[model samples]
Target chain A: MPHKVIRMERTRDHSSARRPVMVAIAGDSAAGKTTLTKGIAAALGASRVTTICVDDYHRYDRQERKGLPFTALHPRCNYVEIMEQHLQLLATGQPILKPVYDHDTGQLTRPELVEPREFVIVEGLLPLYSKLTRACFDIAVYLDPPERIRREWKVSRDVRKRGYTVDQVLAELERREPESAQFIRPQRAHADIVVRFAPAEGHDDTSNSPLSVELMLRPTVRHTGLRGLLAEIGQRTVQLRLIRDEDGIPVDALHVHGYAPREESRMVQKAIWSRLGLGDGDPVATLGDVGNGRRSESLAITQLVVLDHLLRAT
Target chain B: MPHKVIRMERTRDHSSARRPVMVAIAGDSAAGKTTLTKGIAAALGASRVTTICVDDYHRYDRQERKGLPFTALHPRCNYVEIMEQHLQLLATGQPILKPVYDHDTGQLTRPELVEPREFVIVEGLLPLYSKLTRACFDIAVYLDPPERIRREWKVSRDVRKRGYTVDQVLAELERREPESAQFIRPQRAHADIVVRFAPAEGHDDTSNSPLSVELMLRPTVRHTGLRGLLAEIGQRTVQLRLIRDEDGIPVDALHVHGYAPREESRMVQKAIWSRLGLGDGDPVATLGDVGNGRRSESLAITQLVVLDHLLRAT
Candidate 1:
């Protein structure tokens, strides 16, 4: 039919040009997805990155969900098909009038026009939930913070920022646990890199130390220069080890020590940045920003690794 | 690149399935596009038809456009790229979260979900404006009423239904004429069928008769069984002639007399409907409904001709 012929022609025309590199960072609510995405986009330069959250595909507002049988974490609560369609468009270097979900107001607001640039960072709970969406990404990352740390992060953020009481946030977290298990955590298996930020194991002074990061780098995508960089930087700041994953598959896990001196962590960051071929200079100052003028060297290093994958794909 | 490869695969998968047949009816504002689309959709049965207006792609609301240099009719005033992208999706039987423009309030309101069914009738100001969009339709129709008649229709509709003053409507129509000439009228050349409804030429009782229709059927599509059907209906009610179009192209012109008796028109409608293979019965009762309980035989016949083309393409 003419419909098929015309679409095939259009697809050929679209593919002849340069397309944007797509990166999906998926995790549960308050799992530091936004923080990780912000760091990567900053390092890539704001002008070259288009960042969007798939939570905007929510099929219901907060008020409507209160009466529903399932929580927002359920796939039924989202317009997953439209999400797939829009993601396909963005993945092909096209623009989309993306829907807006106002987290502060808990409402589905007016859509905004999003034009893909050199790179696109898609961060949300369901970015990697489907095969169609996962196919759109060149690099997929899943944030897997410890449950205790994540609960603390969620409580503090919701109370201070989202105008929710401590009890309400805790109750909602409990309500979402089952869907999180069924829908959110399973996406970890599809990611090329699974990042876990938590207090360092066997570290006695955890409260005074920053959260360390362990990146489980699967071989689906090449981790260029990562092993050599870790060796050069020394185990005092970062270490790489061969470990058996939960699935009993051998994988490389790179750990960035949170208790390491700031200078040592900066050295690790600098070494990774130098390999990026983005010219001879220090890394971007905004890479590790964690609000209120604070910075995390581990976060910066993790972002650099993700950036390296994106650039290497290009 | 993976982006190109993935998109090509997606396109192939989409084309392997059945896609919706798209029909575009394009014309200037108040050119009777919606009325024509309504009649065709009514004949096709509502369960199998999806109707959308492209005017919803306006980038600015009425208050915002008040201070702009151009009117809504200008190409730059609408999100033409997004419109093209969404049309490509719908043409392939995909759904879209379409934006809505509130005509009564002159505001851009929330978007709504639109899923394409068996037949999609896209009626609007610029559905056939671009090559990409034009490629999506199986049948492209341009409504080209005489400017005098169109202006009268616009003035009456705007003053009565849209809460516009007669003077304001006239002034706005004058302002839009240049853009309409530049951007809107040129699409008429791309249409497979050009329909004009106006007072019959040299008719003595024009005011007492409904508007007659002249359909210039181009050879881009096969107007199956039309000549034989017209011969059977006889020239007193409907006639076919070989005519040269504005571009000096030879085409078939079908004229339906507005003053033809209802019984004679029903015979023409039944002849067309029977050819559709929809079983032995009279044509649908709602084919020619105008607003406020009025019906036009000529309009019903024109809709039947379009329905014939749609079913033939299927």
Candidate 2:
């Protein structure tokens, strides 16, 4: 060899030197974390952002747990503490050897190393389920798909990708329902935004384009900015309806349909971009502030709101 | 609006004229079944072959078997009969929905529909462990790596591939050794050829190239062609003097590595082609006179071999 070569290790971004930001998207299995993340990732571009699945922290292999009494959803059954530590590490701009889940083989065949960048989106069944985990996301979201729709998505996926019979998939769903409801579903209350995607009222189980999105926002003084974000999102290419209901809950809901033409969906995505007031390329890069852990992010904004109040009083 | 569609059903090649040929490569875990199949597949070409791993037949999901007593290698832990049935179907030139395995991720994911074309290579730890299964293979080869070498290979593979620490892999190996000996290693006696890849005597562990072929020639005259086959093999290969002294078992003291170079190996393989003498095309096409459970290629040759007197009379 002519000379020894060295690839420089990536250093932390000084862009967030003044303040830290974090964003978390929590959801049950197949509850649109991927779909939602795609929109966000596309909007944000690549440089000032990073995203990861929380399940990447799982502790056991598929073959190892063949006849166990407890389900995977149980915290005791997982390496929860290690996962929490890794999340903290990633949030602080570090690399971690994330656990790999081969969805096709249903075996943890290999482990891959992941280097986290800036705007991290952590999505999975239990990102919002734990106290320590919840402390790591600045803006937390939980997907709340209707049971029927979620189960249907699961059924189709199992038949197509997994080697299970339709009957076996159904049986598994039944067995999993209790644990899902107990351990997974309730995490919705803890989220800053709750998203639900379901089939339209008229379409039951037949149509291919029944996918929809219903987002629930937690009530806070940030309504003006949130509404502006929704309005901008509405102006985008997609055919999404942003409905604000004053039904005593401080939240917002938006729904996207599989029935909507692709061209229509593109429009709504653009409107969300306009909220940041950028021309050529700064919509997603602007949302870098959203990556803070839930409680810490809350405290930061609360401090800002408090400062604003103190300034008005003075 | 345009309509989206699913993929079309695939077609299988069943020439309706001939009985199917089944080639079985039996070996312990990490014992080169996959490596051997790759060579055979390349030689035969993809147009005439389809290979399926027996590992995909695992019955339990990862999260389900946390505290189970048995590991996946135990026959009872897998759906062996279902796998055998599927093999028979594939051997007969039919396509079946094979299970998907994502070795990197330990998730029992979706099934993939595989349409069989020509050759079916079923490789696994227990491929030759069952009598009914043995009846299915037209030609069977066993991989017999020494215990020490196999252990080292398994360790490196598990750690690099499965996110496992060296200690965990070692524990798993220790646990499986007993079962591996009882179930996997014993299948060697049923093999037509036993392939052992180990370092030659006086060489260090760093020796990378090592292959020994122990031909188990059944005592029969029809196999007079067998000697010709070995001769052809010998042309491309070096024979180690594995002669048994008074003890009667030759393998323990022998170290037979093929002295033939790459070019010579190819020549030996070609010569083997000339000696089998089955009119060039698919010799595995017809079921010649099935007295035993085997799907024989030649009636007269096979009949002579069935009775022990064929060599003396001929």
Using TM-score, give the best candidate's number: 1
Per-residue lDDT of model 1, residues B18-92, tens digit only = 588999999999998888898777677789899999999998899999999999999899999889888888887
- Model 1 ranges off by over 4 Å: A2-12, A202-208, B2-16, B202-208, B279-284
Q: Which candidate is the best by DockQ?
A: 1
lDDT of each: 0.86, 0.53
TM-score of chain A of 2: 0.71
Cα lDDT of model 2 by residue, B1-314, tens digit: 00100100111122442324556778887775665565445445577667878777666656554567877778876656546545654554544445544567655554444556555677887777676566565666677778787777777777876888999988988888888878887887776555566554556453243334343332211235544444445443544344552324444221234344545544434444444332363322321222233332112122112111211221
Tell me the tens digit of each residue's lDDT in model 1 across A275-310. 887666557485887776778888898998898888
Instruction: State in Å the error of residue A156, model 1.
Output: 1.6
A-chain TM-score, model 1? 0.94
The list of candidate 2 runs beyond 4 A from truth reads: A1-314, B1-18, B206-223, B229-236, B240-270, B273-314
